[model samples]
Target: MEMVERYIYAVTQRLPQGQRIDIAEELRGLIEDMLEERNDGRPVENTDIERVLIELGSPAELAEEYRGTSRFLVGPDLFPAYLSVMKMVLIITVSAMGIIFAVETILTPMSILHHFVDLLISLFVTATQVFAWITAGFAAAQYFGVAPPGLSGGYNRKNWNPSELPPVPDKKKQIKRGDVLTGIIFSILLLVLVRFSNHLFGVLLFEDHHLEATIPFLNEEKLLELMPLIYLMVAIGIVKEISKLMAGRWTKNLAIANLVINGAIFLLAMFILRDQAILNPDFVQQLSDSWGISKQQEEYTTIKTVWKLSYNLALAAFVITLLIDTVTGFYKAFRK
Candidate 1:
């Protein structure tokens, strides 16, 4: 009996607090009853107790049974209010994960696919955590008898059918004028910063030759020539922020559009660079010479090929990310 008590405690300890005591008490009574029935009129023994516990099955299984039925905010019931909240949370979490992956992919030499996979894993982890919290809250409410019957399980009311769920209110319609003014101000600031960054890089590279004098093949002037795209990126950012303040659906679409544009630019840049590298090995040789290095310093061909392949792979990843963003954005836009 004591051993059974210990086993039950070990198993139930993993469960939330609301039902732990009740479950433990019920299990204790069950084990005792089993032992008594097994022993009959004879004295209780270790073998009898073991048999009783075995008949009761594993402690883990028993704990699981006590967990009862699980429910999500969006189940067969399709409650509009609950589904709306869950959808919003999922969108926000996935978007944040995408942004994190994009920044990491841009700054690091990691493959785009690797970063994307990481993002998916991260989103899954976040979603699991959200689900766990919701389940725990529901369990606590049910155990304490605090939740109304309507919310405790799937909606069953004839008048409140899943197919007839009420339309979700557009919360963006409540935004005030101040929000628009703030967005405009941010847009202007972003544009100025992007333009200034391009000018600064241009001056440092072409006119001054400050940092470019130190590193070879890092053409700041060429990068500055790409500044129009950077400005476009700033405009996209402004649009995204404004859309988010106005409507979630619009925000998602804007984000996808921005990703598509950036991905396309990255792909074009990679293709041009790769073709140039292949067509003119002398270009690479010149870069080496400018850096006061010899081709024999390393396996020149192997190094150039590897670098080109890596660049191409990174570009491919951008395209894949853009595709994922577009699909997810579309899903969010129409899921309601």
Candidate 2:
């Protein structure tokens, strides 16, 4: 019956993936037996199925029985995504902070050591704020009855209809685990690389086969000042990918989400690269000098022109990547 299938879908959606199949089979058999006993092998009707379902109780109650417990905050439907998201955020945040700390210390060992306590405090404080915000967001989403498809979401759902059941996704539409994981890793790496570009990419000279002097290619203070904007971009990317992972499939909604996130990222990139001070003048001159060229030389002038256009170059790169990603995401999401 349609109602029986709806009830089964509801109950099974709230259960673990591994248990869903067995529980669905068990529920189907029990319902069949109940219907048989009720009508004495007479033609089954929606009325009979309704009565059986009523006896079995609401899907939530039945699922609670199966789970052997009740958990509303971060319930079964949201827990897996919640856990994976939390782990991803925490790991990336911690690793990024560690990279910054290492880079700062290498740049100025004594200075960083003097502010060691401050740095540690900042890391903990940032981590704590991130944790609280993520937990609160999930909690709010649950209370507000918002959730990904194929989930019970919240108690605000007054009815479970057979029509509400999600169709099994086709293989072409299914988002792969490797793809999601790789996207996340690449994003995290980019955030770190950009955040510490000044220290990571610098002019280096050696004397007697020993490292002698170095000049940072980018303006450290300027990049630090724009950290919040960079972080905002990273945050949007994380949300986009997390949604993809949860959806586990492509849809028009996913395509639209990808578009919005990509647009936002491009805007953020424009804002960040708008500041020309991000490149240090001293680094450019020093690099030119190392090549035995002065500012008046044609070669040095050409180098300066190229260096001054770093903003355009970086923005162009971002635009290209964003275009590719947006196009691919839309194509797959809307593929017939």
Candidate 3:
């Protein structure tokens, strides 16, 4: 009876929301009828139930039968997840743009309608890109036979047995929705800032609360040359989040993939950061002049030394964070 319930859940959970209830009822009746016929005046055993379910086919296959002829780009198996991720990405993108719009409105003199129109255009363009990337990521996963937990998501083979069903993931080990949402938003926000406004990471000098000067941290020309590497890092981050979303829980393969992805990012960042030419050498000289320090003085030298070391500090900090995330992922995945 417990197996019976588990089998029913495995089937119905894969279906579209509107059809789940009715299909569950229909599948339940079908299973019962099959069991009765198999009973043959003898006591129905566990073997009897297993045989019946196996004959009825895998939950994924049964769910497909219930869905009937039509096919979907994401397919019914992944449509729910695809839809969920799509909504979050789109909402986060619009909200991020809206906040940027609000700030732009306050900082600069522009017609409200002008800003609003710009927001609309940016939203349309960004949303289209987001929608396409998300759809492609999910489709790629499905095409490659990677699936999330539960209904129609385990191993892909000609024979999918009831026993082969993946165990219900522990919540502690599961990929939390909060985490996935937060990761997606932050990743998108960070990408936007780096791609369009890297200059924002700099000192903004003010005079009597009125803006005066900006001392940019990075050499814009050098950064422009390195934009491809930066984009690569962001792209890797997006893929990592997508993998986490589809995995639905920690796993050995996921932990390893996480380590590899994080490691690649760290290496790429360090590669970029170690090239001190990418940093604005003018930053230290300009600040030193503001402090009234002469070029021949020890103070100026010390300031410059510390300025260069900042990149090293950033690289070290990133490595530590990477290790923490990777180790935590493995612990969660393998814990009893």
Give the TM-scores of the predictions, in the order they appear: 0.33, 0.56, 0.64
Which digits, one per residue and each the tens of the lDDT, describe model 2 over residues 1-336? 888889999999999899999999999999999999999979998888999999999999999899996667767667776776787777667766666676666656668765577668888898899889988888877777577544444223556666665667789888886677667766777776676576556665656664456667767888788888888888788778878977778888888888998998888877776655666757668888888888788988787777768746766777898999889888898778
lDDT scores of the candidates, listed in order: 0.56, 0.78, 0.79
lDDT of 3 by residue, 1-336 (tens): 789889999989988899888888887888888888889678878999999999989998988888785555678777777788788778777878876776555445347688989999999999989989998988887777576544245644566778877779788899987787787677766665555443355676667775455667788888888889988888898789878977789999999999999989888987887757677869888878877898999999898888779767876787898899999999998998
Error of 2 at 23 (Å): 34
Query: For residues 104-175, could you state the per-residue lDDT of candidate 1 as single tens digits?
Result: 554343487888788888888999987677666655654564554335343445455676453454444233
Alpha carbon lDDT at 7, candidate 2: 96
Which candidate model has the greater TM-score, 1 or 2?
A: 2
Candidate 3 clash pair list: none
Find the candidate with the highest TM-score and give its number: 3
Native-to-model Cα distance after best TM-score fit, residue 285 in candidate 3, in Å: 0.6
Model 1 spans with C-alpha error above 4 angstroms: 71-204, 207-336
TM-score of decoy 2: 0.56
> Could you give the C-alpha RMSD of every candidate to the true structure, in order shown?
16.0, 14.0, 13.8
At residue 107, candidate 1 shows an lDDT of 39
- Clash count for each candidate, listed in order shown: 0, 0, 0
